[model samples]
Target: MGRSTLRFRRPAVTTRRLIRGLLAFAILAALGWNSVLLAAGNSMQGAKKEEGGFEGEAPTAILIEATSGAVLFEKNADELRAPSSMMKLMTAEVVFHAIKQGDIKLTDEYHVSENAWRRGGAPSGTSTMFAAIHSKVPVDDLLHGAIIQSGNDACIVLAEAMAGNERAFAEMMTKRAREIGLTRSTFANSNGLPDPGNKMTVRELAMLARHIIQTYPEFYKLFGEKEFTWNKIRQPNRNPLLNSLEGADGLKTGYTKEGGYGMVGSAVQNGVRLIVAVNGLEDPEDRANEAKKMLEWGFRNFEVRTVFAENETIGYAKVFGGNTGSVALASHEPVKVMVQKNGNDKLIARVVYNGPVRAPFEAGQKVGVVKVWRGANVAVETPVYAMDSVDRGSTLRRAFDGVTELAIALFRAGVAKL
Candidate 1:
């Protein structure tokens, strides 16, 4: 199932200023910042929201933690639909990954073919880089053709140039998509030109964008360049949100009669990167504005505040059958909350698990659940794992229980030998 966004729109200055003032007073008073922030406000402007599924109703929309692949929001994230030019992200990503792996070169040139030049309007049609047959253009130009201009001909040329043929390269693409954990995508062509079996979900596209950006930082500049020129032809980027959305960087745009307007866009604001993908849009500009609105709403509303550090003792867990009476409970990672900038303290944290816990636990094994709450509802529930191993009681001697353990161990050892 997909999930709804904890999304809301509000002017940010008021909450920010309030948080700032509270921080200053806390510093001067030498008191806790979290305590002060919690004590001060009672506003919903910064309150936690209810999360719900977005997968069933919409075709596919997903907002993800660009770096972590942690799904922040989603709508039918697994459904396959026309990827539009968003397919070019994969095309570009494949080429770049190849370059990074030394499979091709920056200056390598390819001869354009007639089939590439022949792709024109719908029924397996769309834009062109105006690339002509027999023209020996560099891989760099073909890159622009496939990406900036959304050129089908350029895509085919690059595919053929990198591999012996486009079909081979597309197979490589699907293989790579699976390797990158993209379960909801399949590629039938190098270009995003609508094909009978070609489709991707919004989650897959965003995942591709995040991976390409993070995994190939050295090559990301290509997507940000506003325009490119080759063989006396000029091509501008297709993503309209590049300049229209403040802090917007690079992403791809797509449109086929069936896919409508689609975009995979990201922006960096106050050091946080937010990526949003929307398909089934009615028009190009409509998708662009929706992207901007969603991004602005996200950036404006949230700011992270730490409540506890990893290994910081949250409380003590009472062990049921262990040498120690209690184990120090803590978060495995920093416990932080995304609260409205200046909003009041509606956030609460509670740790729950099976009482204390039985022994035989290992370090980092989850033993309890941490539910972050806002007022009456839970905001997020994450597991709190054992910070260190809690060995099982050694005094007990069992025949059947020990045999079960021995069998499991022997089975694993045999599998390892095989």
Candidate 2:
């Protein structure tokens, strides 16, 4: 055997220490993970490991029923966090509204200003549609770019075109967001570039997703498109569910150095739709996996049961000064709830209202709430409206009823003291 100058080279001791330190941090973080409470649990309670329910890695998440607006699962859903590319959904919604209002046309063309091109276009160190400066791309093409491709460049271009500048466009986005009921969210830019001012809660993001799907069904299909080609370059949609999951259709994904990975995903299975939003994930795979798990959990673990038919009386509320002693309450629409598979019939319901409601209320007046409790947690709350109109009672009757209500209150208080 020839004496070969073959020797094994070992990694530097410092490098080895750094790798070990990183691995250790990951393990400790997993072990120390502070999970939020599930249904009926104390807010400060520590994580209780359970199966067949949502116990995902994302620090914050929410799953909502698209039809009934019933929250299936939530973990820190109201905590404000960076929205990342998810903000583009709002940007697209603004454009969609403008087109719908005839303020802009799908065929209308917008100039790709140098500011948009240099900062967010292909030249910028971010996702871009590769839109050329001074090019006039149609509103429709840019919509696809911003949504399907998640191109920041397309967002900036459309923003400037719509509002003469990105700052003003962001103002419009914020205003429009509030108009659409996203009160806890704020938009600093059209494409959701890393800005401290851009913040949204997982709950509000789900609300916005549902709004887009319901309000703009015609344009919402753009989100499901797999790919878009512009400036001779093609890019696939960043939304992960559209391809991997069967009913996954449209939505957006987001990531930044500071915000980590986030997603707003929706899917429809057997006429039942679910919207899921997640944030604060360190890995993109984790975001995708968590989103899929939540949507599936929502569809699998819960089912919608109509508790009250439209115009069917759910309960009654006392009327102190009305022509009648009480008024029947009913749901204007079919009141439904998402409950555990065998648990639908076990829901405990109660009509909650202040008073004896006042007299002279209309038949359709919303007077009370029908709250359905599942275990210790409230599963759903349907607004119960007055089923029939009631005029004011006569003077003698009103005085008598008022006195009687007062007597009842005093009696209840006396009994409690015993």
Candidate 3:
């Protein structure tokens, strides 16, 4: 979101008037001084926004609050591109769910097939942990290779172990992606290797990262592991931020001739966490620096403001033909907003709903939305629910109220004409 600066100007007076109206000019200037101060403050705030909200060099990028899912910045984030190895997040997710459901165990071992060996093995000249042919690898070691080492062979082996083959496992990945609310992503393979159909938006990648972090906390630590060893060969994690940026932790990186360099990185500083996704960069250092910049911008420029506590009444909504005249409206979770810092624009919240809602509304029924605005941008929009149920009024009372409502409407219309 962007904002414009405000400027103030004083009225001009002629020489003839200045001699006769010195007192009046002084008074006018005194009155206008407050306006000047307000405009200057607005200008400073606008400058801060311009400087702090810079979108980095990545063609597609997004930064979000890990806990609240509030987007702090976005640039072409919804446009689809090849995800490369970034698709491994979903692959990890599938295995995480399978393990949680007792369908698989980390101790389970799978035989590395020749396909995985040749395509993703050492001879592939791509990233790998160099799993030997016909060797048995445990699910735990394979995950380390896939996440920390970015080993394509490890991904294929896990895919085969989970769904019998990479193609079938890719189908499961797509299905699970849809189930997890990734609408714009499609998986052509489990490893996110280059393919015509292997594409994902930056927003989708960030969302998938959030889901994995929140849903699979027990397994997410594997992504932060610095090195993993298999077959007496040790490989370092490809995620660049872990070494250079403080508080940088688990995540994965990707690169392909068709997809470009990209990374989905998450970090927590002082209990506030941010997740960033960046893609389509020519250089790995550029990708790392841009992702770090995006995350730091989010942490520095935006702050979380809790507007209302959970179940606390925000306001009352008028009711029509109900046992009561009104009902309290509130949010199920604490309403929080990611506000741009150093901005004089006050955050304004308004309850929106069809007036005089009909009776018989149950408790917790969704009535409307509490829309909070900052300048022209919507900071947050939270669902407002009825705090208490309201039953229908007596038939006689309902009839009388209906007529009264009509009379009020008619009178308001009549006043508008005046």
Candidate 4:
């Protein structure tokens, strides 16, 4: 027999890595879609609540049901105003984001920069997390000082530790605030310094607070700390509500020569959670009183009704390919509707989607939507998708499906050309 040579080459490392990365990407895409379907069902869309019953509200005031991000009442919720110390909410957000990314561990020590000391201990700084220069402060202590004590010194130390300098870190805070829908906000410093350009709306501040509390529940309790010590100096929490209000868990307070008194307050009463942010007040007492009244009004007037629950199968979808012909559809979290004391109970909960999602389906793939309507108007329309996977079909099955799909496409295309 004549000698024959056949060469076989194994896949290159890059090819293997690409395949692995693509597979991982696909898996993540599926899971993310599933999460959206589960959460998107909880949509609350309505025309701006009409000039609420209450008035004389601060030039800027907002009351939102925390769990559902529903605005119960507002005068100038979206109007731009200085966030005051409420800007720290974003500072805290950046710090938390670093902690999560592992860039700065909770136990990591932060070095105190001279600029940090000046800005934090500046004669202008209302709350100072006292820190001496050339000292290594643990991450956890810095966080407590910034959150509980509203210490500027502590904030700068954290900013420097996380971003090399306070000014650079403040830019990070501004970027994150914008990403989270705080469109009206501009940050000039790590702390809420009084500058013409640095400002935010009560609505935006409330939204930021809600995001931190919800996304980082583990570290959120740090906001509720009553007292904190740094450099052996202990300071009491300035938020008076934490002591008197039931379920008055946490939040932050702010004061400045130009900004007057301002606060972003959160509370939970009777299982109902609320966030209220106020600014441009004349005094601390006024700020506290205004927040309390706003929260009380929200609790007394609005109520939450669950329209769908997570994992609760809303319907099934026809899926082509893989091991099954049909896949289940469900929300990851409960869907809720917040309404006035006596508004509309006749809400129409409906699901709509194109039939038979084609295969290569991943759990949580968005294939359709759930829309909530009150008579002729849509209360909210939440996008939804598949919550599980449907692998490629067998050769024979795929051939049959291809023929069927071709026929359907031809019919649809012909009609559209009409």
Candidate 5:
């Protein structure tokens, strides 16, 4: 496989001329397998402050733009740690998905088992919605209890109601998580109680939060509710951001001796939404403050910039055994990135695909992805598709392409030996 990288310094303003220049640069740069670095200019002087300097006390954290899914800043974002009750987000997602699929209804009632009552109810000495044993509860109330009250009993009841047991429900949670693009998250139980099997990364947590917000707009409102009342017991929402930050709407908070303190929070400012996930803090107050600070920092510093307009050719992908040597690549949606407004950030954009691809593909077929990096983190990545279809080449052309691939493979094998 081969890779092509185009490195350039991001300018203060992005214009049509800059994009055209980058396209011409990509055409020439794609001819070589190695990376090409183009210096547009040196860093601007007299900048008031450097970019990406905001630091938080959380050991694992990530902040991202909600609409574009652009990473603004991250620290140990991929390191898997106990997610605590933040994993309840996954629990809520599972229930939400089932409801969306029409497999269940909000009015459906579940019988609370003795296990749920004894382990997660008032006797458990943990966050509980004070559910009564042997009593039937509606799914609507359970959702409110789980999201707003952080009620372990509510999650357990929902899990049992859906999958017959918490273990099976957790398997469903992990499977559903994968289906929604959360790759590294796993669940042991519904309420994110202490368990060796529950693990998640801050980055994936942020991604999950974004997915929930986008996928279930109606159900997501439950996250922002300040308080929930069930069975005559009313409890306030655990997520402090809802009360502390302006424009803060919904999300969840978690804590345990093992996972420390963690929360997934989202807030909107001036019509721009930002999501933040922080874990492994020493104090609950620190967790709330750190999440709030990160969201504020992201909104204050980053601005979205379009990299490529919709249907505009992003680059090219080499084709094997095709009438044409390469196919033009473009994204269906406009590719956008969030960057520090005043920083002189050097951006590296690359088109990555396993190629030369075997041909006979249709137009709009996915060919590769365009990844843009700001500083050390990937600011944004989007799928690039073929702009036009390519037919199979003549027999002579196929033979030549086969020979070329063989020679290239041998050269790579030799390089590996070195």
Candidate 6:
């Protein structure tokens, strides 16, 4: 219900340059403050290239710190475009989830139907594992083929075995995508061949890649394999990052006449992992080069800094009719962000919740989130919870609080009219 700005005083910085840069900042007020606000800046789409910021060649791209899911840089990251082969990441996630849930096993074998073979196999004139028609292949081999070789046939066979057909499987992919926080991505086929319905933003793709890396570490290593051999035929991994970037690991790549070139990539350096996604590039070399550049730049420029410790009271949310007027909020996990090591960058951290919440809530109940921004992009966000239980307040206290809220609402309305 209230917002305030906190600025960091850069040591020995020139005032003229500081004024021109106008970077945002966040500083927690003294403990027991009821309300505080953090500044908001331009969205990534509108943020201009600063003096030291990385400018990527891809039209849509994002770079983030994997541990904290912090946005280091982004450019048109939410604009949806044909995902091409990058949609395979969704397909892989579904299979991994099914396996984890015991609905399927790696040893399970799926039939290579004529439809799968003819459309996505050797005869399809597309990327294929040369899966023979009527062959029964185990899920393990299929995953290897799909991931290491970008085999369309392998994806179709798994799709048919799992959900009766690729269409139904695509629906499952979209559903699972939403469950994992990929809200804007949609799927039309198992292998991401070409469909108007298959679209994703680079931001979601990066998030998906991070999810796979973190949730299914054992399965994710398949993406980094240099080669996969099946039916006596061998093919190399399609992701260029593994070969080009040091410490680069698993992920996927895509290209189409309509979608251009795209890829999702990750790497670890100094124990810090970073995820990068790029799309809408005109050339394959540009796609590879741009992704590589972004990853290297992130590793070189950014470092994680703890903003708030675990169980540290971050701020308070107003409570209606509780034992007290407000509830203290804190995250079970330490709050962290990725910032430039130079300490020249500014950030904004805010406690966001809809309240004064009507209480009688238990301690540790999730109430809201702490969102921290670096420039215009959200650097990190983590959920905050009630630090202690709040029982119903006395009747007189409730009535007084209600009257106070009513007065505040009326004042806000009058101000709006003015």
* lDDT (CA) per prediction: 0.69, 0.83, 0.81, 0.74, 0.85, 0.85
lDDT of 6 by residue, 1-418 (tens): 1222223344334563453233211111212244453432321233334645797889999998898888888899999999998888999999999999999999999999999999999999999998999999999999999999999999999999999999999999999998998888899999989899999999999999989999999999999899988888988998888888999997999998889999999999998999999999999899999999999999998787777789988789888888897788999998877778655556777888877778789999999898887766777889999999999999998998788677556545644654
State every prediction's TM-score relative to the real structure: 0.67, 0.80, 0.79, 0.72, 0.86, 0.86
Rank order (by lDDT, best first): 6, 5, 2, 3, 4, 1
lDDT of 2 by residue, 151-183 (tens): 899999999999989889999999999899899
Off by over 4 Å in 4: 1-52, 122-125, 179-181, 309-330, 343-364, 368-383, 387-418
Span of ten consecutive residues with least summed lDDT in model 2: 35-44
Backbone clash pairs for candidate 1 read 15-342, 41-344, 54-75, 55-76, 85-254, 360-392
Predicted structure 5, TM vs. truth: 0.86
Candidate 4: RMSD over Cα atoms? 13.7
Report the Cα lDDT for residue 47, model 6. 33
Q: Which parts of model 5 have CA positions greater than 4 angstroms off?
A: 1-52
Error of 3 at 341 (Å): 2.1
At residue 172, candidate 5 shows an lDDT of 98
- Global lDDT of model 6: 0.85
Better of 1 and 4 by TM-score: 4
**Candidate 5 residue lDDT tens string, 1-418:** 1222222323423454465456545544544333222212312234444545687789999999998788887899999999999999999999999999999999999999999998899889999999999999999999999999999999999999899999999999999999999888889999989999999999999999999999999999999999988878878998898878999998989999999999999999988899999999999999998999899888887777776789977678888899988888888998777767776566666788878878888999998888877667667778989999999999988898888777566545644654
Give per-residue CA lDDT, model 1, range 1-418, as digits (tens): 1222222223354565565556445433431122122312223443334332223223567765454344555677677899977888888888888888898897998887766666631223467777767778788777777777777888888887777787888888998888888876888888877786678988788888999889988777777778877657787887777878777778888888888888898888777777888888887777887777666766775555566667776655655455554566677777665555546436666677665366767777767766666555444555676666776654552343344345545545644654
The segments of candidate 2 whose C-alpha lies over 4 angstroms from its true place after superposition are: 1-51, 342-346, 352-356, 376-378, 401-418
lDDT of 3 by residue, 1-418 (tens): 1222222212222443454355445433422222111112212244444655575799999888887677777889999999999989999999999999999999999899998988887878878889999999989888888898888999988888778888899999999999999997998888888899899999999999999999999899998889888888888888888988889997988988888999999998878889999999998989999998888877787777776779977766777888876788898998777767766445666677776778988999998887766556556678889999999988887886687677556545644654
